[model samples]
Target: MTDQQTVTYGIDGMTCDHCVMSVDEAFRELPGVTDVRVDLVAGGRSTATVTSTGPLDHDAVDAAIDEAGYTLVAR
Candidate 1:
């Protein structure tokens, strides 16, 4: 099988399903990213689990969250 990598990130400011979809789309646009799962937490920090074909660039991840109008936090 091909190599794969998964990463989880803490996201702030996601308040609903729309926010979730925005973040999901952001990460999905990145190369190698196969899937993105987000657990909404409203006003609290939420988590995003990303599955990819290989290691994802940390900067790209951060940028994706930012593009989605959320903050990326380490958990």
Candidate 2:
């Protein structure tokens, strides 16, 4: 990616460690994703900063996040 671009997602419904694990695992499976971090505090809002090797499609990212049972807030 260009200078390590970071994409943050406002995730919802992340209630515990399991939520963190699931979200982390799902994002890690993506092709260009390099790292994923999630925060389950504040009524289940996670900021996942995906460091990709190249540009990422927001739709695809959103889909992955949604598939993990979380709603992604547009930043």
Q: TM-score winner among the candidates? A: 1
Full-model lDDT, candidate 2 = 0.80
lDDT to native, each model: 0.91, 0.80
RMSD of each: 1.0, 1.9
- Model 1 over residues 1-75: C-alpha lDDT tens digits? 868988899999999999999999999999999989999999899999999999888898898789879999995
Candidate with maximal lDDT: 1
- Model 1, residue 61: distance off in Å is 0.9
Backbone clashes under 3 angstroms, per model: 0, 1
Per residue, candidate 2 scores C-alpha lDDT tens digits across 1-75 of 155667777888788888889889888888788888777775756677777777788788788888988888876
Each prediction's TM-score against the native? Answer: 0.93, 0.84
